[model samples]
Target: MNLKTAWIWGLVSAVLAAGALAAPAASAETLRICSDPDNLPYSKAEGAEHGLYVDLANLVAQKLGAQPRYVWWLSMNQRKALRNTILAGKCDAYFALPADKDYGTRGMKRTQAFLDVAYAVVAPPSFSFSRLADLKGKRIGVGFASTPQIVLAAQGGYTTVTYRTDAEILAALDKGEIDVAFMWGPAAGYDNLTRYHGRWRVTPVAGEHMDHQVAVAVPAKDAALLARIDAALTELRPQITALADKYGFPQGQPVAVGMAQVQAGPADVALVPTAAGGTPYGQPSPYRMMAVAAADPAAAGRELFNSTCSHCHSPNGASPIRARDLRRLKGKYGDDWLKEAKQTIEEGRPDAGMPTWGGTLKEDQINDILAFFKTIQNN
Candidate 1:
């Protein structure tokens, strides 16, 4: 070969090599997302149906010009799951956190809410539920230690049958054991579509703490990434809505149930007085304080547990992690489970990451937590 031709070929080879080397660097830009492996209608690890969060994550990653990499983590204890995964640098973002700024988001920044999630009333087509009063005299099914159960118990006059999960509640409703089931909207809707073939009517209900906005969360330092995610979410809003429909999420206007004023301490549940017309959606309702009366200890205890213990043990003691599942305490320890639990709470199980609450929490608070646990035991 001629010297000139040889030089030209070497230059061509060098350019190609450089391009090849640089190509992977650009392609290697991945959006690492942490999500629950088993949570359906939200996220899943494997299958044709990857759930709403997984699909949304993929769309966001595509918009960011990055590959999607998932860090599978069971989010039974949301705070702990966030601590172990996203805050621990295992992933770049966590899907579907409450968009409310006051939620337990100390070290993370959340994108604008892309979805509205709320508790829903699932019943047969003939049944109608426009307001809370409609629930009176009806056998309502609710998840044990759930918001619905707490609210119902506080309200009184409503006969609510408690179940461990939303699926159980649906099953009960199907068997004619309960007149209606009030549960999480997304789960109920997904189950209605998949398990029940969309036979039941899943209608979302509006009230305090009944509905919440959901968003993606990232580490606080990832301001640039957060902004990118916000833009992607905005651009993909239409797609997200379509995905929600595909997953059978309850859509359209929610039924407005008049607000209930729930107090954390010992007090009777009072109905929050409405204005001349009615309370607007997403706006705080007017309040008229009534005389305090005795409150349900179990209900009050649930509030405390969710705020404090849910970080590790999970909300309502329904931990998917076997070791931490408070529901199984009775089955595991037999008659002495309560005693064992009390001692454990008083003394820190440092080896297992359980902190001592003896000094941090009051005796009444401990009793309240224990009271809540007793109602949830899987005996």
Candidate 2:
């Protein structure tokens, strides 16, 4: 069977509920790339409608003389989708992923980077700043739980107005809702292009871990095509750059006050965990950035629960993993439920793919997750 057909047999039923699409028809000339249907600036559901990654994918496909086709997979929990979709053979290419070893869990192979993006400032033209201190006392916009929000919070001067989406933060900036927005460069750039016709200013932030290398990723099992992609991307860098400009995505190293960085070449890098957690190249999880000064423990707990744990354990609605059903847990335990939950979480059942988060999360954070869980239990 061709690679696409292999997906049907490999995926567990849980992924289908996450809205994994059936493999569409593919001739030898079609390039089926895995993409999140709702993610903007990177990809989306409709026929290559918009997003930098979708556009970039089409560009590469055209260069390869192949038509681009999407294998839609919701990436809210990318770790799940990576296992159920890309690794399962549902798609051949994943346009943009962090160039780092810890990313993609399975050493998913990647090609040379077409762009390097980071949290950047989006403000009106003539906006200038030398460092984080320059924007002090200004009303700033940041995606809740994002790097900028974390950094600015740590620096302690700006009045932060948090938004859920990068696009929302930019729209808030455009409407005079905030003085500046520190958000993902590509999304802010896309909005500036499509929404404002390229009128907004996007300046990359400088600091350790602020800038991340972005590269095209493919399944690790496939090396023959990976070589071709690497060669094509290197040769197509000029065009890829122009394509980025057309979409309003930041293309090169922003001047130190804005861009340019020396880093190791293309590899898988992990996206930060955002407040809401799972936007690729956005952030990884709220727990990972726990030092960012959470104003409300319960609220922070809620965001973490919904963003990460909600993927499998149904703390509310129906869950696909029947064995993980949290809905009926109220009856299954009494006051000692928390203890049982703690033990289960700290020592995950290895045979079932459940990970032990004990080493990964702090005690307060784990309790925060429990706090959020209590609020949603279906008792």
What is the C-alpha local distance difference test score of each model?
Answer: 0.75, 0.65
What is the alpha-carbon lDDT of model 2 when measured against the actual structure? Answer: 0.65
Best by TM-score: 1
Task: Write down the TM-score for model 1.
Answer: 0.66
Least well predicted 10-residue stretch by lDDT in candidate 2: 259-268
**Candidate 1 residue-wise lDDT, 213-311, digit = tens:** 888999999999999999999999899999999898999689976443355423554544443211111212223323321366676677657645664
lDDT of 2 by residue, 4-44 (tens): 23323223222433476543443335567887887776777
Model 1 lowest lDDT segment of ten: 276-285
Displacement of residue 290 (Cα, Å) in model 1 is 18
Error of 1 at 121 (Å): 0.3
Cα RMSD, each candidate? 12.5, 13.6
Task: Provide the TM-score for each candidate, comma-separated.
Answer: 0.66, 0.62
